[model samples]
Structures are given as structure tokens and as C-alpha cells.
Target: MNKIFETPLYPYTHHPDEDAETPVRHKTIVVGAGPVGLAVAIDLAQQGVPVVVLDENDKVSFGSRAICFSKRTLEIADRLGIGQKLVDRGVVWNLGKVFKGDEKVYEFNLLPEQGHKRPAFINLQQYYFEDDLVARVRELQEQGAPIELRGGCKVTEIDDCGDYVALEIETPDDTYDIEAEWLIACDGAGSPIRSMMGLDFVGRVFEDNFLIADVIMHADFPTERWFWFDPPFNPGQSALLHKQPDGVWRIDLQLGWDIDKAEEKKPENVIPRLKQMLGEDAKFELEWVSIYTFQCRRMEKFRHGRVLFAGDAAHQVSPFGARGANSGIQDAENLAWKLALVLEDKAPDSLLDSYSDERVHGADENILNSTRSTDFITPKSQISRTFRDAALALAGKAEFARPLVNSGRLSVPCAYDGSTLNGPDTDALPARTRVGAPAVDTPLGQGWLLDRLGGRFQLLTVDADAPDRLDVGGIEVERVAVSAAGNETLRERYLGDAASGVYLLRPDQHVAARWTSFDETAVRAAVAKATGRDK
Candidate 1:
């Protein structure tokens, strides 16, 4: 037998005291070495910002913590330089089936509508996930990417004094002090920095608890998401099953706040539960086990002066939808470019405020969805459970009741509707690629539209040349021209029935503005608004 999740642990290194003559001040300091922290550090380093990352642990997460990687997260990983590795090393699945007792309720697919580059989702363990990110960051480090990953380093104190944020970090042997113009808190749900500032998260905590087990065995499980409410094997409780890479199956059993937490986690207690579901003949090895309660909460604002929060530090949702890690990755993507532009003096500092506004809006959406899923799965009151049971009963036979049945909504990219940074969208345009939406991935002649856009401010032109007369406060913008001869999706998304179209895209591949014709004035105005120069 082979261990599919193999990764080398990082080494613990010492941090020297700051030289009195010339202290090495970093532009950005990121806390934690998890996927979200590594991602934000990588994004900042790619944009030529020197970053220092601190982590108490010396390796990737040990277990299959977050197994679901949504499409938006993979796309962001693609831009950060590790999309293919994540795709190639994970189990891909799109179809999901939901059931009640012994009867099948319904099934669904996430990527039913085609025309995108990435799949709907992939199942991967968190250990391999962060390991791959660390490898990529090391590869870039060799090429002059100033990303300093200090494993076994813990942040003891954070001193925020408006102009700059100072950190007192301790290593295994010694302690040192450092300073950065900006600090990104990716330290996770129990954020130390967030605590130091007396910041509180306001949200609901469900009474139900869940037992998650990663079992390694050769079984007849299909490569799909199977969820059951009041299943035959585990009567009166819910269960979820998914196939991950390397023959490891993730099983989550909803034990509604009544079982002994310590006893259920024991192999003696867990194996019998498995026998009821898989029968006595099914041989399996228990790889890992954990018990957790659900809580959906987030900081009111992501930014506090020079310090900003990303990933789990900023918000936290229940594991039902897999929104925890995926949304955290998007937070890094959303803040990195804005921070880089502001640091380089290309944009006003107020541009970072938009990062807070937009991502706060995104966190709210994730929390809302996660709360609804948690409520549906583990209803609090008798009336709520009655409504849930009725919906599940109707879902097995009635087509109209399918929407009411919620196992888990899964995760999706957030469309930032009503964002202040959003510019004009021509009337009667396709709503899919409208302002405040993620730029639709269109298939070009031989590549994808996102590949051509790169990581800069790109002006996507359909049936029009790059605007030569456009100038937005000396901001550098790249123009990519698309033709209708081979690229129909681009025109359909941006131009609609119009003859030509021009779209200004943010550095993060989000649609800023679009118009029926190529107007240099409109493009520049959008740039001004996006960069916070106009507003």
C-alpha cells in the first residue's frame, strides 16, 4: 500500500535581530503558512512586493481538512501559478446525489452549462494543497521572488500605530521584531491579530456536531458527492460521502450534539459506525478522524488602518458548503493586487478600502449560504425540522420541491453586485458578464480569454483595435483584441448583439466596465473609479 498524501516538512529556522544601522523592513508581512496565507504571499511576491510569512508549524496541514476546491479557487490558483498541479493531483467530480432514508430524492451537476476552462470542483486533501503552494513559492523564490517563508515562527504581538504595523515574532530559539507597511492576517479563525485588537465576530453557532472521517480503503464508492438525510445505516442522522484522490473517502456523519466527542473519535467507536454503512465485509483503515461544531461568523470590516485581514482570519463559515478555504483564497486574490498597486504609488491608498468593501460583501454571502445550509441540515426547532422533513419527503417525488431540499449548496465565486468600483454596463447586455461580476472565461482560438489577459489591467476589445488615445492617470493597461471569426463566447458575453465592445478588467480578472463601442473616455473613467482616483 502507498501513502497518496506524501509531503516533506519545512525546516524551522532562526530569525536574527534587526540591525541597528539598517533594519530590513518588508512591504507586506503575512501571518500563517496555510493555503490562504501562502496564496496571498505568492500573489504579492508575483507583483514584486517583498513579503515575510510567519507560521508556527513547519509543514502543510496533516489531514484532509478542506477537501473541496471550487472552480473560482482553481482559477485564482491558476493565476498564482499552480492551477494545473492542483487539477492533476486531485479527484475531479461534478455530479452529486441526495437521498432521504432508502429513497433517492434527486441529483444535480455543477457545471452543466459548458464553455468554461476549469471544472466545477476538485477533491483534494489540505496537506498536499499547501505543499504544492510551498513548492511553487520556492520555485519563484529562485527567480528573485522576494517571498520569505519562515516556518516555526510565531507572532506574539502586533503593534499597529497607523503609519506602519510592527510585529514581534518568536522562533523556536529566539525572538525578533520586524515592521511592514501593511500586514495581512491569514492566521485563520482563531486569529491572534484579530484578538489583539479586541475585534469580535458576530454570527450564529449551530447546536449540531459532525464526525468527519477520512478512511483509506478500496471500495465501490463512486466518484461523486453522496449525501443522505436520516440514512438507513445511520438512522435519524445525516451523512455525506465523497471520493478523494488516492483511494481515501471522506465521510461526514452528522451527530446532532448528543454523542460523547472523545468516544466517537476513537477507532473502536468509529469502525462499528462504518460497518453499519458499508457492511462487515468492507475492509478499511481509519486514516483520520475529527469532531466539530458549526459557526458562521466574520469580522465587520476586513481593514483596520494599515492592517488587513484575509482568509479565515477575516471570516469563517460552516464546512457544509466548503466555503471556508475557497472563499479565503478569493480574499487573497482580491486584496493582493490592490495592495500592490497602492504600494507602488500607481493607485490611491483608498483603493485598498474597496478591497474591504468588496470582500466583506463576499464574506456576507458565504456566511448567508453556509448558515442556510447548516439550518437545513440541522434544524434548530421542531417546526423547522418539520418543514425540513416535509421538503425531503416532497423532494423524492415532486419536481417543484427540489429547490427546497438543501444538502449543501457547494461553493461558487461571488458576484460583487452594487460595488462602488463597478463602472457602466451598456443596456441590454448579457447579465452574466455585467459590472461587478467575475469576467467570464471565454474560449479563444487556441487558448482561453483569461490566458491572454495576463495579470495586468487589460482592456478586452471585440471587433475593435486597442484604444490608442486612452490614458488613465498614467496607469498601464494591456489591451487584448478578440474577433468574432472564431471567438463567439467573448462577443456574446461582452458585445451581445452590438457590433463592437470594450471591457476594462481589473488586475484580478474581474469585470470593471463594458460598453457597446470602444470609448477611450469610458475606459479611462472606469480606471479612475476602480483606482479610487475619481471617487
Candidate 2:
């Protein structure tokens, strides 16, 4: 248990606005200073939008929550200027092993290919992640970024006034009012803001619970995700293990719905279970312990008037796939650019509707996968369990059954396949970089391709003729020209069999459109379609 988790990073302080004649309005206000909130705030501030963040607490998360950071999330973090710090301080792993009743069934490599800079996943405690984000905020503030974080400031009431959102915030010593031209709610799963607005999630809540134990120990377990179904120690149940930074290991034990959660979390009962799995003599100290239920749900709509929701406030999923935090980060990234554009008058307010549409699609994708993983992990009926066991047994001997074995489908980037923002596409280029999909990373010059994209709308040309820059309506699209002549990986990823390719990328690095060759008229229309102008 690091002291950083309890230390106040952003203690409450008096502000001039508290004594103002009226509510001091800001261009943007973010509620809840968690990872997603901080991420979006940083994004907006970097884009020169003055944003304020309000949080009731002043410290990082208390436990080893959200231990897995996906590769796509790391790329987004790179744009936020915090990617390398997370990678440097996290456990990098790409291999996963599954077992059935003490026998290893099969293994999988998440990222088998080369040329990508980031690993498939990194295991770091959520507290460490938040601490680094707060540090990044401080660094950005030092560099004169227009971002403010107010701790111990709990937003008690939210009033959506069509044009702006009025908020009532409570501090330790006083209460005050403020207004925001646009509001972003990144609160937790049990979001008070969402409750205040009388909104609710609509999805499944599985009747099962999982115990998470963050144990500090010196173990020889390889740095890979290991999952066991009906292991000896936890008979008739499933378990998961993974290495984290600072000699910590995260263990998850599935407990059927009937058990008492509080008793299961007790060390008196938890230690014996650990001893059974670790041979009675293992030396370990419990750093954190908690029980969680599987819930795959999301709000009907993420946007309401001028207030928008991101992260757990908008959607939630089972922990098995590591989609919770990762998807939330994606939500933040998606909304930040759109909100920024709308506020700057570069795009219409209808552009924000695409945020809701795209993220709801993402949430539904995560929910579907998470629900399937939960069902497979915890079969409701005996026949379902029998089928799962059969799949597990066959996975040990046959390659085809391996795909049926669901040790929890690991998190992957959600491609907005049919988003309205997606522009024209050609079958000539690679499908991996197709319209609405994220731009695949490849080696470029001495660096990586993603490092150059960096949260900007750009024209990616692979040996294709395009202008140095183009002003589509009011938005600037810079040209990034790279020849695919000597770059096989780049050609394979971007050009494929096509002689040349041109791509229009959104600020989030998603392919808005692609063409075999650049056409000025078509490019302008694509930009209009992407910005919600055409609609």
C-alpha cells in the first residue's frame, strides 16, 4: 500500500469565484478527477480550452483497480503526453495462458506481430496511473495550459439550461455555484451526477461476484495473464492471475452469487484460500482486497443537452476483458476532440451527437463481449457448465476448441465500422486501416507512425500526391507524406497491393476516409461528412 494513494494531491482551497457576485462561468467543466476525467480535461486544455475539474476526493484510487492498460489506450495516452511514463512504470506483457483443473489447456499471444511500438498490454495499478496523470496535469499547468483541478469540490446539483450547465458544488468549508458552457461527467459507476439527472443504465447485471486480491509477494510466476477454470484450490470455480508493478500480483477468484461478499473479503477467510493455491508456505502480504460483481451496462444516451458523460459514468463492463478503463479512455478521447471543435465553432453542435452514437456503439460492443465472457465463465445451468467444461477439455487437445475457450477475450480497440463520421473508402487499401478504423502503427523514418499522428486531423499519404496542407471549410488538415518504396511494413499496413493511398484521419486518429488517389472535391466532401457539416 503506497502512501501516495492516501496522500492529498489536490487538497481543497478557497477560490475567488466562491466570493463572486454571481456564478463564474467557464468554457468547460469536468466533474470527477479520475483517470478519464483528468484525461479529457488534459486533452481539452492542450487544445487551448480552459477547463475546470471538480472532485470530492483529493487522492488516487485506493486499490489496484484497472490493472491492465491496453495498447490502444497507451497510444491515446501518448497523445496526452503520459504514455511513456505509464509504459515505463507498468508491467509489459502480451502472452496469456489458460488452464483446466490444474492442466494447461492452451496459450495465446495477444500481439504476435512486430513493428508496433507498444506492447499488447501493461499491468499497472490504477492508483499509479492516476498519480502519473495528476503529475502530468501539474507539468502542463507549469507550461501554462489552461486547466484547473479542484479537490474536495463535490458537485451536488446539475441543471442543464440548454445553452450551459449550472452546477452547485460543495467544498469542505463552503458551497458555491458555477456554470459551464459544456459539462463532462467522468464520475464513477455510481455516479451522483447521473443520479441527480435521473438517468439510469439499461443492461445485464450477472448474478456472480469476483474477489480481487492485490498481494505483495516475490513469486516466480512469468509476466503473463494466467486463467484457470476449476483449478484444484478453487474447485468448481475460475481464477485469474497477473503480475503488476512493484512486486504486486493481482488475483481474481470467482465466487458464485450466493456467498457473503464481506466475509469473502476478510483476510481471515482469504488467507486460507491463498495458502491452498500457494502451498501453505508462500510469503505474501495483502495490499488490497475487494469483491466485485459483473455488470455490463450503459446509459441510453451519453449526451444530455450541454452535459456529456464519459467513462464509468456512461458505461460499465465486467473486469474480465479489461474494457472498463480502456473504453472509458477511448470515450474521453472521442468526446474531447469533438467537444473542442464544437466549442471553437470549427464544427456544429450536432457533431457531439456522433460522440454519443460512436461511444454507444463501443459500449454495446464491450457489453456484448463482456456478457459473453461472464456467461462462459459462470454458466447458469448444468448443461452450460458441461459445454464449457467440454470446450475446456477439448481446448487442451484440439486447436479448434481453443477459440471456444473464453478465459475472457482480452480488450481490443473498437472500430466504429459504420459511423456517420466515416468518409469514403476504397477496397484497394488495407482493411486494417479502413475507414472508421484506427490507423495501424508502422515504422517510419527512425520513429513510429502513431507518434507523428498525435491527436491531429491529418492527410496520411503513402506515395500518393496530396497538397502540403488543405483548409477544409475552417479546419486545417496537414499533409504527412511518406514514401512506401523502402518501407515494407508501412506498405503492407497502409498501401497493401495498391500502388499508392491517401487517407483522411480524424483528430482521434481514426480513418475518416481513404482513397486510392487524392481527389480535391472528394476530400472536401469527406471532411464535411466527418465534421457533421454534411448532415
TM-score result, candidate 1: 0.96
RMSD vs true structure, all candidates: 1.9, 0.8
Q: Compose the digit string of candidate 2's lDDT tens values, residues 137-234.
A: 99999999999999999999889998899999999888999999999999999999999999999999999999899999999999999999999999
How many residue pairs of model 1 clash at the backbone?
0
Q: Could you tell me the lDDT of residue 358 within candidate 2? A: 99
* Local distance difference test, candidate 2: 0.93
Give the per-residue lDDT digits (tens) of candidate 1, residues 1-535. Answer: 2343444356675555433344456889999889999999999899999998888887777679999999989899899999999999999989999988978888989999777888899999988889889998898889998888888778888889788888877777767778889999999889998999889798887888899999998988788999999999988889999998888999999887877999989999999998889888888998889999999998999999999998889988999888999999989989998999898898888988898999999999998888899989988889998999999888878889988988888998888888888899877577888888888787886788776654678888778776643456777887887786666777677777778877888888888998867777778889888888885
Which ten residues in a row are the worst by lDDT in model 2? 454-463
* Model 1 stretches astray by more than 4 angstroms: 1-8, 16-23, 468-471
